[model samples]
Target: MYTVMIVDDEPKLRLGLQTLIPWQELGYEIMGTAANGNEALRVDEEQIPDVILVDIRMPGMDGLQLLQEIRRRGWDTHAIVLSGYADFEYARQALQYGVEGYLLKPVNKEELSALLQKLHQQISADRLEKQVHQDAKSPEWAVYSLLSGSHDLANVSIDNLAKSLGMDWPKYQIVLISFPGLHPEEDERIRSFRERLVTAYAADGQSLVLYFAPYTVLLLANTLVGDFGRADLYRELQMLSGEIRTHMDVAAGETVLALDQITNSFRTARSLLERSFFYDKGRVLTLETPESYRQAPSSSKDTSLLDGEEVSFRLYYLVDVGHAEGIHSLLDEVAAQMAIIGKGETEIRERFFYLANETLRKVSPRLWSESIYPGEPAQFLAGIYSQRFIRDLVGYVTAVMERLARCADYTSRDNEMRRLLDFIERHYYENLRLEMLAGLFNYSSSYLGQLFKSHTGEYFNAYLDRVRIDKAKELLTQGLKVYEVAEKVGYSNVNYFHNKFKKLEGQSPSSYQKKS
Candidate 1:
């Protein structure tokens, strides 16, 4: 579907224009609205519309000025002018900019509808003509054939194809540009990529551009191999990628002289692009990268370093203990191990997907909040399957481990309090305070005091006093001296211990010992 943008300074007029026509019914979608020329330009920067409905008079920049700026930037966007007054000069300037329709303000619905219908037909015809007129003799068609390389090419040679396209260059290389992490709309961006490449290179020589699914192929003729011939194109592509805010990777094949090596050039470049996850992004990968990452000898390739299940088990254990540092460390080790595992990319991806699935499954309902961990098993598998590189996938797994670990950390509050209570029970003779335990266990003293009462049904100090006196009673009954039992029960002041014991046990230590 075609996209259109409405640019006008009047919010009321802009709102009126929108309701005045059924945009999608006429084969166009109103992608966005802008109040002024500068805002419209920003919108255009993000996504250039197929058509523009612009008000001729607006603050900051007029409709004619906007059109001129657009054309200056080489965007041949179709324009429909809206003017409150049909001044002769405005009409003349709009005509100069190739305005598709000039409509008076307070537009008639039928008039705007008719104009849009005509514009839609024109755009359709233009697209159809462009596709129909693609010459079979062009180098693009020949590149596609040669790059397709198979036994079916027995009847076809690069010499014959090159002569048809009149290319006598002794050196030819295939450079593949690919965008990873582009989701459902990637096909549209692929088309846009081809258009940009064709426009940027049409004048240099025959534009050798074709789309091979995710990769856009460009055959540079008589160009030096490696970074020498690619510096300019790489800069331009990097800029294009910046516009889309997507990471782009370029792989240039080694220089080849024969027509048949065209397929080899294609294969090498495609392989490099596919293996980009192993290497870094944003840099051009070339001959050496693909070879090194290609498969090692039998001894190396067959050696398995990453036992996927074992890694998952370790991750699960770390999550159970709420060990964020251990999780990150183990994931780093897993990345290193995967590198040495020497498995195929697809196999590695599959193995890691299982590992992630198994690890996430261990995050219990208490630790797994839906808000933080939204991915399901199938989604995790698909995400890992589609991730562009090893680094991004590693990051994804690390985040899962760390975030779930945090969830466990938060949920383990009650458990830490229980451990603290048990510590008090075993060390009643040692001096302790609610504040000291709170600081050691990373809690506030007041909060821990409340938690202690809530868990044990008594205040912290009161509970400690009761435990000491109860122990003193036992020791005194076993024939220990009053002062000795007092000191042993954590009360160094024998008189104070005697008073506390009398208060808790309803008598002095000697009286309790005789009763027992």
Candidate 2:
């Protein structure tokens, strides 16, 4: 369907045109409505529509100036001016910028429909004429045009183009090859497999070879001569990749008996080659691999398989325990797995940023004090996001991890132990438990229990009960009810709270408040 946009200064006119016009019945959908020229320009930058209806007599940046700027910017969108009886002079100058025509302020439905029908027919006819002109250039251009979807895929057109090029091949398949870290303008393969193509398939110079940078596409023209199939093609491509110590994917689709199917085969091969991230280097990826490997979203990441927070916690724990070898191995695994799931560079950067900013900072808070991620937190987050590639991002994150592993004893020392006691003293009215602290501090529950007992001369639960009872006594002395003070000190059952209070202070809550 054709997309359209309306630009006018009056909000009422914009709404009237949007609701009153039968745009969908006229083979168009209003993509957006803009109240000014500046707003219209910003909308078109994201997605340009096929046609635009703009007002001629607006306040700032009138339709004539908007049309002129559209022309100067080479937008190439068909524009129609909304003019009144007094603005005929401005409408006349808009024609010089290739506007379709001008419409009166109170536009009639018949005039707009006729102009749109004429423009649609002209657009379709011009596209077909351009394709026919490109198809008749040469034998190679005709073959390339057909493979690249420039020509209309009519059976008669394909037969005629094949006869004119003096070709009789009945089978075709596409093989896509890519060199990850090399210049595409220069190819350094042994050409042995390409020689095999000439001997078995396209005997003449009929093989359509095209280079789509970083990838070389081979549109193989086959006959009924040899038993060469896609499996044999992959075997030969593997040998070539192994000898050169480089990586390539032999992602070939099934052979087709029609020339029109070459486009589908080409697209399929390109999609499958993206799955090579799961395989090792110096090998090929076949059609046997599954299409997707990304995991589903979850909140708690301890059980999740592919969440970025899993890596965040794992790195922090390993750094806390001083496992140097485990940290290095995890860094490599994360990069490879993200590549396999088809994550772009931007997504990889954000994932690594969570690891650095949220989890790893707790281990060594001063870890980049003379920091790469300096200034405010926004500057620190942007520092991780400024990397241009996966290797550079991995290198930066690796440096941070190595630095953290050396200086990661923030919570393991005596002063930090005092800090933990201060944390409990500050948040004792809330529900506090040793298991929660173990997870937050990346320590074992049993180990943390023993440490708390040695430090405070009481078990973790008994110490928490005493802290809560002391706060409850203060609230009771301030004329709070027994049940009110019980709930305020983190107790849902007042009876259970009374039992704990009597055990700790040798008195019931009502008696304690009366004595105070």
lDDT at 208, model 2: 58
- Model 1: runs farther than 4 Å from truth? 1-134, 149-166, 179-189, 212-214, 222-232, 241-249, 290-305, 374-382, 410-516
What local distance difference test score does each model get?
0.73, 0.66
Residues 138-206 of candidate 2: C-alpha lDDT, one tens digit per residue: 554565566556655455667666666665467877777776654333334534444444454345655
TM-score of 1: 0.46
- Candidate 2 local distance difference test against the native: 0.66
Per-residue lDDT tens digits for candidate 1, residues 1-516, read 789899998899888878888986777788889987888888636589999999998899889999999889978589999999969889999989888989998889999999998888788656544543474556655565556442245666657767767765677777888776553123476677678887776557744677654577777775544555566667877765545667788988877886667788888888877777787555678865433333333433212336776566556755654556666555555665566556567776777777777976766766666426686556656787776777677777778767777665444455876657666676689776676566445578999988888988999989999999888878988999999998898998999998898888788888888888
Q: Per-candidate TM vs. native?
A: 0.46, 0.45
Backbone clash tally for model 1? Answer: 0
Pairs in steric clash, model 2: none
